[model samples]
Target: MLLFSRFAPNVLLSAAVALSVILAAVMLGLAMDQRWLGLKLEAQPRLAIPASFEGLWIDAIEHDSPAAEQPGAGIPASVASLVSIGGPDQRSIQLTPQDLMEEPDALETYAGMRAFFARQDEIAGILRSIGGVELGVAFLGETQTYSVSPKHQRPVTSLPPSFWMQIGVGLAGFWLGAWIWSLRRGEWATRFLLLAGAGLMISAFPAAVYSTRELALPGRLFSVLSTFNHIGALTFGVGMIGLFLVYPRRLVSPNWLAFPAVILGAWQVVDILQLADGPGLGFHLAVVLAMLAIVVLVAIQFKVTRGHPRDRAALAWLGLAVVVGAGAFVATVIAPNVLGIGAFVSQGEAFLFFLLVYVGVALGVARYRLFQLDEWAFRILFYVVGVLLLLVLDAILIVTIVDERAPAFALSLLIVALAWLPLRDMLARLVLRRAELSRGNLFRQVMDVALTPPGRDQQARWRALLENAFRPLSVTAAADVQDPALIDDGLALAVPGAGGLPGYRLDYADGGRKLFSLRDAELAVELTTMLANALESREAYEKGVAEERERIARDIHDNIGVQLMGALHSRGLARKDMMIRETLTDLRDIINNASNPDLSFDEMLADLRSQISEHLFAAGVKMKWEVESAGPAILPLAAAHTVRSVVREAVQNALKHGQPKSIRVTVRLDEDAIALTVADDGSGFDPSSVQTGNGLANMQARVTSLGGRFNVASGVEGTRIEARFPVDIVRITQ
Candidate 1:
């Protein structure tokens, strides 16, 4: 669980250290286990002394080693009928078919398995004293005897399964302990878990090496390893008891933990030194007491953590894991030895089974955030509640609806789906105070940030946008982050710089109500990406704006500036008037962005009319203006500018060409468009004879280009120019 959990970058702690330790432990075990692999053991006859012991069986020897040359060494199982070993200056032991079990079993009572290993020990001692793997055997009912030396060390190509199994358990146990320790360096429970794992490793690694020995090892070396194994096992038991005493609630002061340690340490010492009458029983009894102590302490924790649901939940799972794993080990392995009974499970194999405790602890911490495992576990927790709620509802409906399992269950399922699907999120949000990350909302906010003026203002908006999105308790500049990061086990979330804003780390999401989850880290990435896109767009827009401004500057200098210089040099008023008119005409070429423009139609019209009236009056023409409205008084800027150009050009035409006496300009505003008419009482030109100037053509082109119509009616009585233009270019209005 720790291994997989750490793989998720956003989930929780980084356990490189733990994983390193596990690897180191595995390598160490492999090296130590490889030390004793001097024979091809498992594939050979392997001393297959069946529990029924049916006279010692042997396989046909293939090589002429010392043991292979013995008389009975080549005999098959059927030919052996081996009964006893009473050779001169060698082992004197009796063997029969109905044998005592030397294996660990799932069903064996504790008392049935105690003497089994001690007897094996006695046999092992005799073999160690035999100088070599030479055993004398006397066949039953035959009075013939033979001796074979079996210990021929060879090039072993493989290590046994039990060796690897023990190594695997050791690695996992140490990894779990280290993983928890990394989550919080100083928690008491975490320390206990590590202690437990250390003990298991100490015992398991040695056992992996010694238990898989092909034959007997040096008696002294064997004794030392055995003593160390006991020390590790007892230490493990004591560690578990200490863990329960402190976790979920403290049963005793942490300082007082030394007392149990000292007591168990002394018991272990006594067992090793053989000060007690039965060393095996003393060791077993110490383990049993520790297991019992764990049970009692777990009960106390369950009771003490009652008011806190989270604590209770954590304790409940951890408690169950501890109880089941430790209880199984005690009942199957230690209890039987203590009771002097036959153990169904072999001691070495039972050591492997004991590893389940660490596995369970890892799972408990991973699933429920026990021992500071962090908040990602809560997502799973909510789903767990949903499952439990569904079961409960199903049961209630089944009982109440009576004999209608199908429909009742279906209804229950539907109800739970509806209720919990939303309620689970609601509860999580309530508990965690998480924000909903809406893409639409995010888009708008990013656009607003993009609209901010680039540089410091835009950068500020970028920062504000992140703050608004996450609502963290605090935000600080984090320059080192080059990408999004959920760091300090999700205590802070960091996002890289975007849109001229510096990178930042946000701490304690939702005012410390919750840790940032993997989902939050993902959101940070998305937000950063969006901000980057927006910033690119803004940069593009600003570039276009800069080019447009430069072009305008050139236009002013080349057109208006040159004309003004000429006007300054000119001495005549008529020449200056003509120059001003030429300047206004040149101004028409200035670009106007017409897409999606909006303004008050009435205001634009009134301002244009005022300018036209003043110009016409100054030109000595009587001016009468009228405007009609159809409401929804807004129009595009392009339309307004077009109207202004037409009005100005028409007045110049009537005054300069036709020599009008009076001019009438009328504008009509409608919901979708505006219409303009300019009439002058003057000498109208003949249609076929008189040629119009650039003024009328420009007006006609401008009006028609915007999907509008233009017409000129000229007669001897007067001339009238009329044009209609769409007010909205892209459906925007006030």
Candidate 2:
């Protein structure tokens, strides 16, 4: 029970850690997938409008019409008061009779008879009425008589409250969704989405308040809405500027474009302050300037998208949005006021156009991915919206077309909506399937080499993969075996067979041409050395086995021969037995130690000391010993074994080579380091002309491998051999 209790916490912690790691991996994979899709989508087409609208005009008012005489029948106060009277060549006159009265007699007649032009649609009505008159209207200084007949214009319908409410909710939902997505990554696109949404909300305020039924707080609401609208306009301008800076090729800097917009926006605020009594000329000028600025901006946008083929589709969609938005705004607001159109149609058309324009702008900025899904989505949106619009407009058109009833238009709209979805879906499926097939085929060819073994046949496969992987970028891979001459053809990828087998190289290119190669010459040399060592080890192992069998046979023969010779010479049995026992014991010990390599250094040292003590006691010589080391005495097994062997050999040499009378062995740590010293009082020889035997050479080699320094000094006073290995290098933890 206690064991289970103690282990449960650790088990739970381990599980938690594993779960966290798995979650992180899944999240990372999802992020990578999204990034991959984004890149693929970026390469697709864009939509935009062409740059042309140089000659267009709309009439504002028809003074000869009965609608103008009716109370509340003239154009909306906002539209009537702001329209310009003169053409671009002449200084613009206000929409007042006083300005016309000051003109010359010939000019006054023309000016008095001229229809006020606001939008393109208004021109038709004025031209119809003035067909018999000799006077002409001047547009950009060109005078021309009306060409179109007068027809009774129709009224525009208002959108339902429910539909607008739904639009508002959808916009709010989109913003919330975007904000949630941004909480994780906060990318530039996400920030742009949030900013655009906020601007839309601010811009919607004045329109919303103006439509409300409540009148008590109308003045306060208007003031608040105007402030918000002005601020929102400024923010939108700044956001566009930022967007251009970030994507300079896609969007031009609005430095020149924004100046006129800002000035006009300020003028609007001043005009609002003066209410209906604002300076008429100043007000009309501001409106004209604002329209011109918008036109210029749209033209610039068209140019940018046209020059870049990759941006064509996205720019196309965006361009449609701008055109529809701007067209709607101009047709409703400017056309009716300039050209003397009927008030009922003018106000209603203006609102409807404004709504359509708003939708276009929203889609352009926030829903770029809709374009990648195929043009079908746009076709669906356009036809569906357009058909419903036509039905609503059919009632107005019927008065001119054939005097149709309102019920027929509503029935047409219902039929169009029902047919739109199926057609859109079928088209989308056909387009997407073709796209998917091409993408899949390209992916398969590039990855096929990774599944196959790499050899001569695979070499071509790898080259194919490389070429396709960097498609539109030319690359060639030459094998060292077949194309040795081409190996150094600028790209230095080492030829595989340049030296021998089992070697390869890589080459990198800048653009389509070879830049440099990375060769594994050092790796090739190391592999060759390893092969040589393996061959040598096998040869030595075979020789060692054969020599061992021969040695065993020789020992058996020598023992038998010695026994026979001893019997003939009558040698002593006891001495022969002792010699045999000693030889056998030495053989057994050597075989046992070779098999058991983990023998401790301290144990070996103790054994050596015991042997030395026994021999010295027998020789009637006294020996002194001293030893010291830090902490618990521990040394690496290899170092310890080597040191012990050298010390024994030195002691034997002292007894046999120098004939020492007494020996003093000191093994103590020097300060914070390990030190071992062996000294003996013996017959010392000359310092020079001493030969180093095979045994001495073998001892030096062993110590050298262990990175220890060995020193031997000989003199008349005494002979000394010192071996020292750094304690720091030799010590090991228990």
Best model per lDDT: 1
Clashes of 2: 38
Model 2, span 141-229: residue lDDT tens: 44443222222321111222522442353244233223322331233333343444444444443333332211111233333544454
Cα-based lDDT at residue 74, candidate 1: 44
lDDT of each: 0.66, 0.41
Expressed as tens digits, the lDDT of each residue in 127-197 for candidate 1 is: 44444433433334453555454433322334457666777677667656765665565677777888888
Please give the distance, in angstroms, between residue 94's alpha carbon in candidate 1 and its true position after superposition.
Answer: 4.7
Residue-level error in angstroms, candidate 1, position 353 = 2.7
For model 2, state the Cα shift of residue 701 in Å: 8.1
